[model samples]
Target: MSRDEIIDITNKFLVEEFEVDTEVVQAEANLKDSLDLDSLDYVDLVVIIESNFGIKLESKDFTDVNTFNDLYDLIGSKLHAIA
Candidate 1:
């Protein structure tokens, strides 16, 4: 998927699942601390990412992903690798 597609999916998921403001869900929005997503929410986020991107992400793939930029890079890399 493209970067805009990823951001769009993430924005929709965040708004629907987490009840967050769509305007706040930017490409640079942090997921862990900035978004205040707990462990359960993180799992759900992972599920959505994998399901939408058709990529299986291991837990360790997010170990060092702290920011939205980190997530963007990770997703792009994983999708590229799988492709």
Candidate 2:
């Protein structure tokens, strides 16, 4: 999948699963701050990534993922690795 598709699907999941506002899911937006995600939310996020993208993520993998764009790149890289 292309980066745009990854962003779109990730945004949809954030909106639908986390109940985040569509406008808050911007590329530069801070994932934790913008979505008010807590530690429990991270667990759900991991599940979402695995179920949707078939990518198993570790907490360390998200250490540098401050923004949605970072997440897009991480997911993209994992997809590429699998492909």
- The most accurate candidate by TM-score is 2
Q: Write the per-residue lDDT of candidate 2 for residues 1-83, one digit (tens) a residue.
A: 99989999999999999897799999998889998999999999999998999987899999899999999999999999999
Model 1 residue 21 lDDT score: 74
Off by over 4 Å in 1: none
Quote the positional error of residue 41 for candidate 1 in Å: 1.3
Query: Which segments of candidate 2 are over 4 A away from where they belong?
Result: none
- CA lDDT, every model vs. true structure: 0.79, 0.93
Mind giving the per-residue lDDT tens digits that candidate 1 earns over 2-78? 88887677667767877877766666667675567888888998898888788989889998787777887888899
Write down the TM-score of every candidate: 0.83, 0.97
